[model samples]
Target: MLKQIANLDQNSGNTFKLLTDETGCCGDSITPCKYVAAVPVANSVSAVVVKDRDGNNQTVTFAAAATTVKAIRDALVTAVNSVGYEDDGNVLPGISVETVSTNKVVTIVGELIVVSLTTSGGSVAATATCTEVGICEFYVEWGGGASKVLTVNGVNATLGDLTFATASAANVKSALEGAANWPSGAVATVVKNTDDSIFEITVTNAQSTVAFILDGLRLTRSNCIVDYV
Candidate 1:
């Protein structure tokens, strides 16, 4: 002779306190109880860090999903410009940066002498007698594919030819200094080595000339092409 009864309770919060029991209240009676459990929901956020070229440390931080590649590239460019060239303000003039689409190039325009003479001076005589003379005129011709001519002096003289009166050292020297039509494209200098004495003429363009044609008392051509490609 047993009897059973059940009861339930509700709470105000999202969570519920549970209570359970299984027993006979009277001789054979039982009461049952039950409750609900609660769970929590969480939200996650993402972020990123930006670093310098040296990789030493990050200079800035950004929201991960909010940042774009274009924005990051612009930031890098700004940082580079602010840092300046080589970390020094003494960058040379006439140098500029050019951008071609996705390609970046740097161009530098300058003038430099490419062709040079190693040996030029030789002994000349007048009337079979050695006299003090200098070089009067020196002409150089293009030996490479390009056709070009260069005159080192203006005065009328002879070179590389002994058939005429041998020019003295003084005559040769005077000719080099007194040429009226000398081309200003290059510079002519005298260099004395330990073993030999010679004159050097440096040409502005090496590939433009093939050989030098000396026209004076005698006409002679010497192969002066040092490099060709």
Candidate 2:
């Protein structure tokens, strides 16, 4: 017996029709042998709408059962061509994405200094009486060449006294492993060494050539680094 099966619509916007039938052998004169068979046919169509750089919208249509990946890609190319960036024939630069992980630290070869620092989290006060302070604030600065000001609490200080935090040898080595100040360019995580005294900052950026800057107190930058990629 021949039967019409159900139709299927795929998420890719393709439609398919299914048909089932019984096959008969050569002995039909007396009695026919039957075998089940299934057949499928494509019948769907799709269209793509894209916006050109000039803010114009374009449409590309695909015929029923005739849409190929290559054809769709070509249509997209054409649609994109319909618009230009800045009215200048040149194409606009694609957004840059990247991940960066680095360690920043302020090292004292000798005497300790008092300072005040601010971060996204809060402010930390460092006094000359102490040898070290814990990392508190993590700074994240995005976009190349962008300057940011981080207020540090201090009695009396000058720009020259401003320095990136310095990590001990152990901290420097482990810096990439732990969570640090991750900015917009990337995601960051810091891991502590097995000894637990050292840490590594790891950063991953989705795009290339992106960098992040971390600024804060000694405790803040203890195991963090500026990520540039």
Candidate 3:
């Protein structure tokens, strides 16, 4: 869901960030006090070779001199958007190029891979906590906005579900953690902020016998920018 944290105008004296949901959980809620778009941290990449769903290859090359994070991000976006990146008569579905916090972030919904990497490469890999081989798609929401759908793989056994009232993230976590015969063979854990506004699902024991795939990390919203908050 689309979420926004605001600052009160001292003159206007309007309600501001440190948000609270209808459940009456305020700044103490599980939501982050501040949510800023993620930027590339220090790390270098000589080149990033990406393969599309159609097996078409696109190479994002970083100039040896372009060592800064911004430079690498710019080069990657430019190369991916270059003509002929997509296969003839085909479109890259649900893939978006965006600038967040001055960093380039790609929201990919299908299979993608880095065929090659150099020592300059940073540890860029999937974040889904899946350890099995099937795919599961679900709708997740933060605060009181529309739900965003994400397709996750078996590796990502952990997922978050939110409720406004008597239901708390703890309750959800307890149920999931207590589930029987988890397919991923991993026990799950749920965590929420003290205020219970935000929550996360994770695996107690992480195994990688099978690869995990995630449709995308951020949700699609206005202006083609993936909303992280």
Candidate number achieving the greatest TM-score relative to the actual structure: 3
Question: Residue by residue across 21-134, what tens digits does model 1's lDDT show?
Answer: 234345422121111111111111112122233434333322231123344334323432232211111222212233445422222111110011111121111111112112
* Candidate 1: stretches off by over 4 Å: 1-178, 200-211, 215-229
The candidate with the higher lDDT, 1 or 2, is 2
Would you list the C-alpha lDDT of every candidate in the order shown?
Answer: 0.26, 0.27, 0.37
Off by over 4 Å in 2: 1-45, 50-57, 63-75, 78-186, 195-197, 206-229
Instruction: Report the CA-based lDDT of candidate 3 relative to the real structure.
Output: 0.37
Task: Rate residue 86 of model 1 by lDDT.
Answer: 15
lDDT of 2 at 67: 30
User: Which candidate model has the greater lDDT, 2 or 3?
Assistant: 3
Candidate 3 stretches with Cα past 4 Å from truth are: 1-41, 50-60, 64-70, 86-114, 119-172, 181-229
Error of 1 at 87 (Å): 21
TM-score against native, each model: 0.20, 0.23, 0.30
